[model samples]
Target: MGSSHSTPVAPVEFDHHLVSALADNAAIPVPSPARQSTIDAHIHARIQAELQRLREDEATVRDEMHAALEKENLDRERALAHDQDSAASSATLLADLDQVRAKVDRFHARRDLSQLPALREARDGLVVCYKNNTSTPLDCWQQVETFRASVSELEKQHIQSLQ
Candidate 1:
């Protein structure tokens, strides 16, 4: 049988605290105060610039909205003024048309008299009778009474036909 020999192993001592400290230091960055302040200032400047830009944009939008509203109000006022002018003109035109219609109605009434020669003659004769005798025309003339009775009978017949 061969003899077997084993060498004794030495115990090694490790500084765990030093290793842990080194590892902690390596994991976290520690900046100088001046550098940190400079970085903070840069960040602050960027934030302030962004805020100022946002404020300017908001003011621009507000101005645009105000201008738009003012323009709309102006347009509405113009439209209303135009409508009023048109209404005034229409009223004047309507009045003129009514006056013209009254003249036309007078002409039509004269034309209707022309169409009824007998009525026109009877009316002329009655006028003459009244002119000839002012106080006692009814007793002297029968034409006026006949014309009135005819008109009344014609109106009654027309009403009865409608019913």
Candidate 2:
């Protein structure tokens, strides 16, 4: 806005002086070869040490993961074995319960039989008669003999079933 002319401006006098002085007397400092090699060796040693540490850390992590996987496999095997054992034990217990229930059912069924009821009533009546002395041994002998015969018949049936 101030000047529309395209002509170049004059250079500052101090810039010319500074450039001449640097050209005549300035010296750039460079590191010695021995010092630079020592620095390079130090950097290389640090890099190698860091790489070794990382490798060790990676190996440790791999070993830990392998051990964990082995443990998990072992635990899974133990759990499966335990489950199988539990299933076998449950089956055995169920079979035993079934046998016991069948025996109870058989006992209940036998109790309901007409012969068993009559035998029980006859034996109880004979006992009462004996306790009251209302009948002589000769008088109740027939009922006692009948009860004994019925029990002997039931025992024979049981023995035949076992055979």
Candidate 3:
């Protein structure tokens, strides 16, 4: 019901006196020398301790899972082997592994390579940025993030692709 225009009008004004936060040299609060040495140390220590505990728990869980899986796999293999022993004319290693599942794992692993280029490019860009901006390492933050993201994605893909 209102008038239509090609460009919309702004409710606010854009003034010439714009201030950049980076350009502002305002004072920031800091701890004293002694405090600075220990500032956030407790938090950091707690974080490291928690990380270690989690890592240990993960390893324990992984081991238990691995053992359980292996035991399960072994049981299945033995059953299959028993069946094969009863019916099969000859025994072989291939009898233990399911060919269809193996093929699927292989196919997934092959398809998972699609992101390798992006990962490599991110790493190369990070290296180049580091070389060019040695004085300002912060410039490489984007590249670092890209690389981390790519690595994380690849890890997830690998985990999913695992047989």
Candidate 4:
């Protein structure tokens, strides 16, 4: 705590040239409010246009899918119709086969009757018995002929039913 001496400090002063240089360096041009708004509007319009294009593309895909489904349905219907027609034709053919089978059965029956030796032996026996018998009426021979005609008629009726 000896004698204290204080030195006086000078007040700092700003240089005008430096201030002006700094102001010039820091100055930047700003866009007008209307021009900035117009740029924003343009961006918004482009975004809306893109959204609309996406919607249209979605609709087109849906329409194409619908058309494809309809075509598939038509194809299925056509296949079903073809199958029905084929089945009907097959049924008709089977019916014809049944008729032919019946006709063949009739022919086989007739051939078997023609090959029967028992019928010929019976006929020969009847002839010998009639020649030996003096009491057998003449009407008995006519009755046998009638029975043969009835058998022939029955065979003809069976053949007609097959046709």
Candidate 5:
């Protein structure tokens, strides 16, 4: 509940009024003893109000800081969980990769890697197409497609020979 009789103002803001009046060279009448006591009481009330406002502001900042800490803790927990998941997948992938590599090595030992002439010509054409269409590489799509078709044909031929 707020007191209707007193509208609180900070001590610094009240001093600003006094400073401006003095800077304007306004004449100030010397206060009688009764007015002096009244002025003293007013200044005391303003100081109390300023202290109260500062305390409230401090409380709000403290609450915000605590909330930010809580959020950071949650983020760290999520990151740790993600790292654990990646570690598990990485271990499984490494094992699979080793098996694939071993199979490939064995296959290479058994087969001769003869370079087919058509595959070589297709690759060369694709290279030239890329060089000529430097600024617009999409123009090399035809060359790329031709190269892919050449590769498919060669793979089919290789499979037939293996059989």
Candidate 6:
């Protein structure tokens, strides 16, 4: 029941067509050309520096690997040389042993011949003792003389061989 009074609201005018046309022709925002070049230069410099560092690291690794390979080669050569030396020494020792064996065989043959004189003397003594009707012949006496002679010869030969 109060007097109904309504203030009139102003009507807002919008240019829909103009807004639509601007939207249709709108350009995408971008950095300035100079700024873009500066950014590209910075990125290129960083990449170049990183590449140089990587190259340096690769060179160092290659050098270390080469040094290690050289050391391994040196070790292998040393081992080979040592093996060769050992083989040479072993061959010499074997040759010396063979020579000693040959000398021993010669000595044994000489000793066998040296005993023949004593054996002949003993046979003669035995015949005389049997003819005289004495006790058994002293075979050991001749054997002792022959053994001493052979031993003396062998000692001389052994000394010569040693010298």
lDDT of each: 0.78, 0.79, 0.78, 0.76, 0.83, 0.74
TM-score of each: 0.38, 0.37, 0.34, 0.35, 0.34, 0.36
Candidate 3 lDDT, tens digit per residue, 64-154?
Answer: 9999999999998777767857456334445556665786777676664444788888888999999999899998888899999988997
Q: Between which residue pairs do clashes occur in model 6?
A: none
- Candidate 4 has its poorest 10 consecutive residues by lDDT at 113-122
In model 3, what lDDT does residue 20 have?
48
| 119 Cα displacement, candidate 2 (Å) | 88
Candidate 6 C-alpha lDDT tens digits along 83-124: 978778878999999998988787667556445665455555
lDDT preference between candidates 2 and 3, better one: 2
Question: On residues 13-72, what C-alpha lDDT tens digit does candidate 2 reach at each position?
Answer: 768888988877656556799989999999999999999999999999999999999999
Q: State residue 87's C-alpha deviation in candidate 3, in Å.
A: 5.3
Q: What TM-score would candidate 6 get against the native?
A: 0.36
Stronger candidate by lDDT (5 vs 6): 5
Query: How far off is residue 116 in model 1, in Å?
Result: 82
At residue 15, give the lDDT of candidate 6. Answer: 100
Off by over 4 Å in 4: 1-30, 85-163
- How much does candidate 1 score in TM-score? 0.38
lDDT of 2 at 97: 95
Name the lDDT value of residue 3 in candidate 1. Answer: 38
Over 4 Å off, model 6 = 1-29, 85-163
**Comparing 3 and 4 by TM-score, which wins?**
4
RMSD of 5: 19.2
Which residue segments of model 3 deviate by more than 4 Å? 1-31, 84-163
